[model samples]
Target: MHSLINRIMPSASGAHLFAVVALAGLFIWFGLMNLAGLTEATVERWLQPHPLAYLVTPYKTWLPYALGAIQLFAGVMIAIYAVPQRWKRVSYGLIGAISIASLSLMFTNPVWIESLGGFPAIGSGQGLIKYVAILGVALWFLGTKGANEIMLIGLILVLGWIGAMKFTGPEAEGVWPLLTGSPVFNWWLTDFGKQMASNIIGVVELITVILLTGHWWNRKAYEVGLLISAATFVVTLSFLLTFPQSWSGGFPNLSGTGHFLLKDAVLLAATFILYRD
Candidate 1:
């Protein structure tokens, strides 16, 4: 199995390039969402529950927008960081800023314990907690020379397990709002109703897992899996635009649902790694 994986995986340089592009895309996409007020709920949710929430309460009106602009700038810098020898250092600075901003959420978010199921149990907070791994990946990409196959395996397990859960009654019901709001998925709800629509999505995700894991055995299957995985994230990420309620506190406070979907940013990045490898 190890030999087969090595044979199928992309060359080290190719994988590294793919990872950079994927990370840049995520930063840009997420930054735009913040600047456009699409992720206002998320920003608010993260800030309002922090121990120092009162300190920033006075600047609440404009803080999110300012942060959004920073995000956008950092993403652009990261994208072009390697273009010129001088710009490389600037890019590292931007990456540091972005990393600090994201990792700081660990201290600010209240749901870290209960919603994420504490330490032993992985629950809804899995979305937020996964940022730790993302941070590590960023560090690895910046400092290391080789691919981290373990990260790819981690993504497969998380996505596959979550995809499988979608078939269950509770899981199906959980995604109803997202399905109803999504233009791509809304039709499923209209045509098949909630349960079946959820089941359909489940099947798609399961198939994605098969394709991802099958890369060791079938190159064609891996290519198809990458396509499906990209499409899935595109559809899921669109929920930020379609669902107004995803922003629980009007513009910036993310409700439970919004928080749940925000993690797709990391998942989207992971997809790129899998696609190349």
Candidate 2:
């Protein structure tokens, strides 16, 4: 057992391989569970409390399958290929397709936003993030070995979008009641801590992106890129867990579609770590 444990322990690349496997498993498991006819009540009781699950009703039926397939492919590539040079381009293409389609789906469907409340700018900004991210993915696909800089640019654009969306517009029309604390844990929009946390994270991410981009030509570029990717993975996972697990299923749960959106982020992170090594 000791020897086996040592064997499985990660190398610089292995760390990323393990993460890819875990991520793939989560996608397959959650996706399969939802596709199966498991009772929502039972699943909820077993999983613990989360934001409403019924909200993601529209996208869940298809999105999970897509995600599961991607995760599975990613895990397999990492495991089978010691060096990702050949597979890297394929992975980027898959991720790019997923990102572009997911963004289109999100913007093309207004029912979800309307079901809650529609802010024009928020919708527009989300579209922009996906657009820029697609460009970032394209850069990687073009065999730019140091594609981290492009990714950093994407992150900065996304962070700006996030901050602008959260801190301004209809949501920010009024000065907050100081008494209402930050909405850190609450899944709903009303929570002050949650909004503040989102904005702060966005700002920090913007700085990180800028630094990572500036360091692209530096000798330590790969190292810096890996750090940025790790930070993003943490944030994406945190966002996933912070919201209700069912949120991915439909309406009240933005987490479902949101998870698909993060798919590229994960792929990008993995790609960078691999490229750096």
Candidate 3:
């Protein structure tokens, strides 16, 4: 098994380089997008319905630009080597902070479809959940001693939370748009009922949770879980190509759904890190 994995997998350094470059690019791209005011309209809308709309409304005009500057700075600082190592760590912390802030918005925005009984049936919440991965990436790159185990734990938490959501009726209905827009997964709805399709996904996700949890006790289970986890991220990220709703306006300007799927790239990167020997 070790021989097979080595033959199939890229070197750890190569994978690490890819993740750093890819995430840096994303940060830069999003920063530029914000600076261009491309997403100003979206931010405007987000502020309006927010619980603290009054306080945010005042800063609405300049907020996007500020966001752009922060993201751009973080991206640039992390991508280049001229800066001190501490600065790179700061950039990673910035990205992680940004991710945490984004996740906090899920509360203001309500991830659980309240109409569908709200606890676990995440609808619009999918957009924010991958922030977990974003945080994981930051931690991973920071090279903290236990960051590898931390990332594994993070993955398990997210997979368990989101996977459990799939079992509920609301989540089954919630994925309708993604499934309908997705060419590969659309068949799941056609071949099996909505609930059943969701159930299948739920079961598989739960199995991964079990497998990954067995990482400490069983090496084989850990490796198998990593493979499955990798496949799961790869497929989800593929939605960018297969789903029409993935993009809006043009390539850089993604729709809400597109943004939701975009974070999977980093999540996939975390899985790569986990595969390291």
- Tell me the tens digit of each residue's lDDT in model 3 across 1-277: 8677655555799778868876887789789889998889877765565677787678889999998999999999988968899998999999989988777777776566787677666777776777777787888788767767767877787788889888888778766666766777886664787888888888998899898887789977887787788788788888888777778876768788777677777776787788883
Whole-model lDDT values for every prediction: 0.63, 0.46, 0.79
lDDT of 2 by residue, 1-277 (tens): 3343334334656645554554444334434544443334433432232233355445554544555566456435544557465685565565556555545544434413342266444543353354454445444445666554555555555544454554543334321221133243334434545456456545655555555554446534534544555555555555444434426465333443353344444445443444443
Off by over 4 Å in 1: 1-122, 129-140, 143-148, 251-256, 273-277
Most accurate candidate by lDDT: 3
Two-way lDDT contest, 1 vs 2, winner: 1
Candidate numbers, best lDDT first, in rank order = 3, 1, 2
Pairs that collide, model 1: 40-252, 41-252, 41-253, 41-254, 116-125
Residue 224 in candidate 1, Cα distance off native in Å = 1.3
Error of 1 at 82 (Å): 7.6
* 1 or 3, greater by lDDT: 3
